[model samples]
Target: MTGEVLWAPSAEGRQPHDRVVLVLDRGELRYRDQRKLQGIWVARGDDVGRIQGRQGPDALDIGAAELRDLLCRRRGELKPALMDQALVAGLGNLLVDEILWQARIDPRRAAASLTDAEHARLHRGLRRVLSVSVREGCVPQRPGWLTSVRARDDAACPRCGRSLERRQTGGRSSYACPHCQRPP
Candidate 1:
């Protein structure tokens, strides 16, 4: 999650940040990690399933009905439930925050308490945000997106222009618009 797998024309273009380099006939596939937080695993056949079995379905492929069911079965706050790799895969902190912001749902809300409409909104937001994020290969800090202003000294909600609130949710720093996302 903290590194990039890039394809270079040749090994000559490898950067100082590249941790591993694989020279192929066509090009060089390099893994670059400045922080060294990423790992490479070699799996074959059934071993692949063994690794994936520990996690939930990929976030992008999960259906709305499945998401609702998953949430209904979860405990604690929505943020933590969503961040749980076993509950929903492929979603990290930034994605959960952005999805909650887009859906106008409070991150601190009880996971199983979401209304039908809220569930729909959450699914829609997940799809919309993830489609764009997957295309960009990362969460883009666009001006209109909450990620753009979350770390600002005087951040304002991109939607309501209200002051953004910061708090610890599920052991991670979370940003939300007080006006847009009310308490559970």
Candidate 2:
């Protein structure tokens, strides 16, 4: 969440925040992290599998059935379960909140409490959100999207027009529309 990879026309264009810069034949690829939260680890062959074995299936690649099964196996609230990289990789607080909001699921609901249709909705939301985010190159703040107004003091649900609610879920801020995401 705190790291960025930027490309520059030349190595001389490196910024103060750039932690590493690869001088390519035509340009430079720079890794920048203001918080230094991400790191690089090199592994060879089987070692790579061993290193990544603890992480669950990637959010972008996991199938709907697999996601339902994974959630069903979790014993915690939905938000934390989704944020746990050991349970579902590639999802952070912001993405999980947005996904739940999109799925119209309550963040406080038990992880295993989703109905079959709810699971389907959740999976679809994940795919759609990630696809748009990947295309935009970031979690875009656009109209009709939760991210657009989530941080505003007077934010309202883009869909329902009801005031948005904010709370601390699993130690991270969560934004949801109370009218859309009713408590379980």
Candidate 3:
């Protein structure tokens, strides 16, 4: 076969018995004691599957409509709204911090308080940050990127360097440039 052989215990063995079941091209082998298949070669092929884009953490596929709906009705804090897996999928704590920083929205701001312009900015920020993160795997901390602050507990804001403040939001420690993102 062109695919690898993945093995599972036979029904009898799974229940409680010494009988062994083996599957081979010749046919099924049933032995009261044990059965072993010889010359059973599994092949690895290059055409296994096609590459797909990164799906969010919950593995729920999200489209534009669902994203808009989730954002519109979300009544929690902005950080929590972004962190909800069912709402957008694939969003993690780092992504939320980066998105809020990029959009200049305070983590504590209410989701309903976001203006149309701010919402647009947030949408753009999410796409931009997630795309880059998925491409490189995790948030990339380039020299100018804000993710540098995430690495250091005492790391100051890259933009203001006024001692980044860490706060708990949605059960996660959120780091923000106090000067850049003010509480709304």
Best by TM-score: 2
Please, what are the lDDT tens digits per residue for candidate 3 over residues 1-184?
0112234543333322324457665544544322323322334564322212122323134444456556678897778777765556667678888888887778878876777667777777777887787777668887656786677867877777678788774455788777888754
Q: lDDT (0-100) at residue 56 of candidate 1?
A: 99
**Which of the two, 1 or 3, has more TM-score?**
1
lDDT (tens digit, per residue) of candidate 2 on 1-184: 4478888887676778888888899999998876554566679888998878879998889999999999999997998899888998889877887888999999889999999889999999999998888787777887898989998899999989999999874456789998999964
What is the number of backbone collisions in each predicted candidate, taken in the order shown?
0, 0, 2
Model 1: CA > 4 A from native = 7-30, 34-40, 168-171
Best by lDDT: 1
The deviation in Å at residue 84 for candidate 1 is 0.8
Q: State the C-alpha lDDT per candidate.
A: 0.89, 0.87, 0.65
Q: Estimate each model's TM-score.
A: 0.83, 0.84, 0.61
For model 2 the TM-score comes to: 0.84
Q: Give a tens-digit lDDT track for model 1, residues 11-125.
A: 6777788888888999999988865543667799999999888899999999999999999998898998998999999998889999999999998899999999999999999
User: What is candidate 3's TM-score against the reference?
Assistant: 0.61
After superposition, which runs of candidate 3 have C-alpha atoms over 4 Å from their true positions? 1-68, 169-171
| Cα shift from native, residue 46, model 3 (Å) | 25
